[model samples]
Target: MWKMELKLTDKLAIERTRLANERTFLAYFRSAIVFLSSGFAIIKLEMLREVIWIGYALIVIGPILFFIGLFRMLYVKKRIKKSYQNDPD
Candidate 1:
């Protein structure tokens, strides 16, 4: 009975970790979208002509954010897999 309880607890913890990981990825994705949209707006709007560098910077940052987020998600996934494997329960 104790072993069964431990297993159930471990399973729940793992599920929670996975959900948290997904939430983090979604947050990153949202940030990337915001960066991309802001970049587009700056580049397209005539008022931003005096400071076009900001727009280009945002455009460059958008993809960087996306890739960084991707890398973090994969890294967390691998870590989680390792944790699960190491768990005796």
Candidate 2:
């Protein structure tokens, strides 16, 4: 009788990795929100002439971080997949 060979990835720590990715994403998201909020606060303070510089920074920082977070998460997932496939077991 022939025995079927199953891969180690079939039991890899996928759930943990996913959770970690989510946590990291959320952290970035929170930072983005805070930056955007700061921008809005500055805009609302009637100091647009003087504080406009900070507003521009906030406008760019949030989205930039969000995209970076998304890309990094995908990269990490790919790396984990590779590790799983190269398991010694």
Candidate 3:
């Protein structure tokens, strides 16, 4: 009798895809950070400081993008599960 068996489950089969997804998420996070920093800089700028709405809008947009990336990950996870569960025929 064999002590162990080697198999490729659906989740394991798509590991690279999952990793790519993670990399994409990190990229979005980087963009979000850049936007946040830009917003703070704008707030500190003498001439631009008066534009309170622009600063506030940028700050709000950064977090919204981050949350969108987070939700995309969740959506992809569900898609992966469904793909793995489907029958080939």
Name the top lDDT candidate.
1
Best by TM-score: 1
In the range 5-87, model 3's lDDT, one tens digit per residue, is 32567446678778888888898898889888888888888888668678778899999999998899888977975665442
TM-score for predicted model 2 compared with the true structure: 0.71
Candidate 1 lDDT over residue span 16-57, tens digit each: 998899899989999999999999999999988998889999
Q: Model 1, residue 6: displacement in angstroms?
A: 4.7
Better of 1 and 3 by TM-score: 1
lDDT of 2: 0.76
In model 3, the runs with Cα more than 4 Å from the true position are: 1-13, 50-52, 85-89
TM-score of structure candidate 3? 0.72
